[model samples]
Each structure stands twice: as structure tokens, then as C-alpha cells.
Target: MRWWQCRLAAAVALLAAVLALGAAGPRSPAPLRFAPGGRFKLALFADLHYGENAWTDWGPAQDDASDRVMAAVLDAENPDFVVYLGDLVTANNVPVANASLYWDRAISPARRRGVPWSTVFGNHDDMPFEWPPEWFSPAGVPPVHCPPAASAMPEPDPGCIFRGTPRVELMTAELDRACGLSRSSVGPRELWPGVSNYVLQVLSHEKPHDPALLMYFLDSGGGSYPEVVSCAQVTWFHSQSRFLNPDGRIPELVFWHVPSTAYVKVAPKATSEVRKPCVGSLNEEDVAPQVAEWGMMDALAHRPSVKAIFVGHNHGLDWCCPYEKLWLCFARHTGHGGYGDWPRGARIVEVAEKKHFSVNSWIRMENGSTHSHVTLSSARFS
Candidate 1:
């Protein structure tokens, strides 16, 4: 073959290869926008401390009533999905049989609805004491003593660290048993398995064009259970953010059992004898640090991808937007199904493709007799 013929053939082969490569290149994701007149809704209920003895006055009947109410509400709403924020059952000193029963009843409604549901660990659900700590207790360790009263503790215990008020002692003991931790001390491992605190990335089947939403469910076991999320969780979070290719976007939602931060009131000094606010009292401006150790607030504060944080435990209606751009919502508890002045309630949230959404909360009154609804709309985002 001639030299010119060989060179021409080589050039043609290279050109063909380049064209094929171009055709296989990745395509840009479509811009997410809410379908005009398209309504997407999901029901959210938390703190459904279901089980025997959960309520003071009623037992099985109350449980059944609560379950009925929840089922009825879901049927009425016909939402796309249901999310139980946590505290599915109250585990304090309760037998595993009771816990299982309550959980069965509580979840029955969602199951009957045949809708998908997901959960994050709440202080009550899956925390050590919900089950017998003996099963989880380390061999050769002596059981820790439960303090008698709040005054006996040397320091202020957040969430009743000592004396186990409102059954904290019993819960702590159970947690100790579950984690196979030495009763001599409770640490992080017994509470959060795998990494202490970690993020779960959920890709939306509905909105494939949007970035995968990351839900960072922190293990706020507090003094009751060992700190599960350690420095590693924080470090991994930072690293993950760096390489995240949400198609140039951030997570659309974040779900955790505890609030990123909370506000507490501090006392003013009276002429000289200054006293800090009483321990255990809610502070107006205090924010609970993430990981229970070290500072990750700065990392979360700077992450623009985080759209909103959903938390449960307060069992009341509250909203906080600490950062000008972020939204914090507290979901109401579903356990009030039996007792308590607080009505049993749940939230329904609608998310749009354009980063716009609306939240509506429903409360069951007269012991699941009727439901009252409240709706809140977010300032549109893109």
C-alpha cells in the first residue's frame, strides 16, 4: 500500500472514534419544576409512643382508638407516602412484648394504606432501654445506679440525665442493655450502629432531575445512650460534601430527631451576683451542638445545599429559621392518641420541582374524633 493511502485511513478511523464518543456523553438533567396544578403530599407523624401503659388512663382501648384515628386520617388524605419521624413506641421499662404490640398497632394504618414509609431513630425508638439492657449489657459490668432526684446530681443533666425523671433512668438502663455496653458506663457504640451519626442520601423517584436529598439523622442519645456520632461522622460529612455532584445542587431535605440548635434563656446579673439560668430550663437562643461533641455547626451553616431540617421530640408546633436561607420544622407527636392535652397530629408536605413547597399539619381532637388542619407555605426558591 502507498504511504498516502495508509495515512488517510488512519485519519478517518480517528474521526469516527471522536464522533462516537461525543454521542455517548452524559446529558444534563432537566430542570425540576412543579407540574402546574400537580399536587404532591405525604403524611408525617412522630412520637407515636404506642404500647401498653403509654397513656396514664387508658391502655388497649386507647391504643386501638389512636390507631383508628391515624388510619382514618391517612385514608382521608390519600397522600403519596407516610413518614413516622420516630418514637414509634415508648420503651421505658416496658417489656419487649408490649413494645412489639404497640409498634404493630401504630404501623398497621400505614401498612393498610399500602403506602411506603421510612423512619429516623428518635430518642424513644430503638434507643437502648426500649429493650432489656441485660441483653445488650457487657459481661462482668456492674449496673449503674439510678440517681434518686434532680438535686442529687453534681451537674445539670440535659433531658434528666440523673434521677431518670419521667422514666429516664429506666430508659437509660434499657439502652445500656441493648448496646452490649458495660453498665459501668454508656458510650456511643451502644446507641448508634455503624457510624455514630451519618447521612442517608435518598434519590427522589419523582424528581430525578433534582439533586439527591441527604437526610442526616443524628444519634442524640444524650446521657441515656452513648454518643453514636463521633468525629468520624462529621469528617465524613465534610468530605462527602466536597465531591458531591448533585448536578451542581445540594440536598433538598434533611431529617433528624433532634433540632440542629435550640434557644435557651440566660439570666441577667443583678448588680454583681450573676446567676446562670436554672439548669433544665429551655434556653431561648441556645442551639444543641451536633455529634454531642466537637463543632459541626460551622459545616452545616456553610452548606448551601441543605434546604430544610425536620425534627421531632418537642411534641408541639414550632418553626425556626436560624439561618436566613434555611427552614426548621418541628413535627407534632402522634402518641398523644391516648392522653395528654396535646392533640394527636401529623404533617403533610408538598415539594415542587422549583424548590417550592407547602406544609400542612393536622391534629386529632376529642381523642381522634376530628382533625383540625393548619397549612404553612414557604417562600419560593429555585
Candidate 2:
């Protein structure tokens, strides 16, 4: 072949390679931007508790009711994003596959609306029903379960239990396949093992990667395990927060399933004069822990940019209470599959992109009534 022909063929091959790379290039996760006028509204639907009972009519009926509640809120709010604050399914009572079915039902509303959403694991999320109920232990006592070696026994020993995949695996896989919405953009690695602990950045209008506001999702351990945010999880939060906001100029909001110890303190007086009745339950059993100061609450308190922390473990307790400089708020229980017969609703968080970052929140019931409106600003924080 002539030298010119050889050069021409090489050039064509290089061009083809470049085109292929461009076509199959990685799609960067789209950053959630502020809406016009710097306003972004997020709907938090907590404790959807899908698949409360797999083999019973009563459980399915409740799931349908919960579906109605989710549909109503999605239609009413039309939020930019939605966060499912854990307890997505009562996994312990149902098989792993059936539990995933419930996870699908719960996220359908958001998926249909084209709204981006994320989730943080609740205590009961991935718990195997095989684990004994008594293992959760009575008040103030940590759960005592069979040792890890017992899981290796081949025979059906009453004392031996089998744990296959981690609880978050199937649901995370289903979400990745079905809706492609609930998967975390943050970590599936050892740094945040066995849970969904990640961060989502709300970018500014001016810059692509420049974050205006941050959203942190942590896994507060639960189910066969005790309901506590481990020290390692707290360390992960601090590490991620520093990486995301080096100068601490950006504001943030944290989401998880279980409420903190400070929650009990502010919950009693949490009511809105402008909104309707705050009807719900707040028993001692619903609270997470005051037995030990885990430093998560204190860590948040020390961070000036952390505006508030939101949770949804107690299906009955829904209120926004002031704790330290930040607000510890409960998402109005929106599930019928769980223990409550109270009115179901979701919490709406609106963050403004003004000179100083500020926030306003309220509850929207299935009937479209708005309640518990509160505004948090630098002025209020101090």
C-alpha cells in the first residue's frame, strides 16, 4: 500500500474511536438546580411502609390507602424532588422479593411525575423477619441476637439464623432497575457500608459543580440492630460535608429515618397557629435515644450551614421543633400500612436562593389542607 493510503486509514480509525467514546460517554448525574427566583420545593414522604402484610387483605388495603396519600401529595405539591424518609417496607414480615415489590409501589408516584428523588434507610428497612421480635429487647436494653458463627450452620437450628444479602441490596437493585430514581449518587463502598449514606448537591444557577445548598442522607441503623446512628456514620458525615463545602459557605439539610434525642424535647410544643390541628401520637417508645449522646446532634449544632435535620420513624409523631441552632423535624406519617390510623400527609421543604439561604416548611394532607408552616432563617437560628 502507498504511504498516503496507510495515513488515511489510520486517521479514519482514530476518528471512529473518538466518535464511539462520545456516544457511550458517562452521563454525569444532573444537578438539581434552584427553580426560577431561587425557590426549590422538596416533598418528604415518610414511612410509606409498603407491603405491611403480604398474605393478608388488611395489609394490601393499607398499602392502597398509603398509595392514595402519596398520589394526593404528588399531585398537590408537584415538587422538584421527593425524599422517602425510610421505613419503605415492613421487610421482616415479608419475603425479600415481596418486600421489593412494596418498594416499587411506594416510589411509583414520584416516578410518574418525573420528579427526582432519593432515600435514607430506616430501622426496619432491611430487617429479616426470621430474626426474633424479642431480639429488639425491652426499653433501655440493647438487642441480643445469635452470634455470627450461628449463621454458618447448615441445618435449621433454632439458634442458627441465615442472613443472605444485606437489607438495602434488593431494594437498591430494584430502584436501580425499575425507576432508576432511588439509587444513591454518593457511596455504595466500604466508607458507608451496609446502608445508604450519601450526599446530593443543589447547584447554583451560575456554576455547574458549585453547590448552593447541600442534602445529606445518613443510615440510622435499625431492624435486628439497635436504632442508633453509629460514630462511624457521624465521621462519614463530617468528612463528606468538609469535602462538599470547604469554606462552610453553603447551607445544608440532613435526612434520615429515626429521630434524635433532642426530638423529644421540642416535640411537645411543636404546633402551628396558622396551620390546622396537629393530631398524632408521641409515646416514649417512638423516641430514638437520649441514653447516650452520639455527637451527631452536636455535630450538626456546631455546623452553622446545617439548617435542619428531618426524620420519619414514628408514624404518629409529626412536628418541627427547635433543637440547638438547627430544627429537628418529623415528616408527617404518610403510610397506612403501619400502626397509625391518623390523617396521612407529607412535609414540604422550600429553600430560597436569596442573599442569605433561608427555608420554609409546612405539611400538606391528602385533602389538600396545608398546616404547620414554619420559616427558618439566620435570625431564627441564633
**Candidates' C-alpha lDDT:** 0.48, 0.73
Who wins the lDDT comparison?
Answer: 2
Shift in Å, residue 301, candidate 1: 2.1
Q: Which predicted model would earn the best TM-score?
A: 2
Error of 1 at 331 (Å): 0.5
Tens-place lDDT per residue, model 2, 227-315, is: 77778877888888888887778989999888778776655643323121222333223455434457888889888888889898877
**Span of 10 residues, lowest total lDDT, candidate 2:** 271-280
Tens digits of lDDT, candidate 1, 274-359: 12211111112233333454444556646666555666666644333334344555555566542244556565565543344444
Clashes of each: 27, 1
Q: Which stretches of candidate 1 lie over 4 Å from their true place?
A: 1-40, 52-57, 127-214, 222-229, 239-248, 263-293, 320-324, 337-339, 354-382
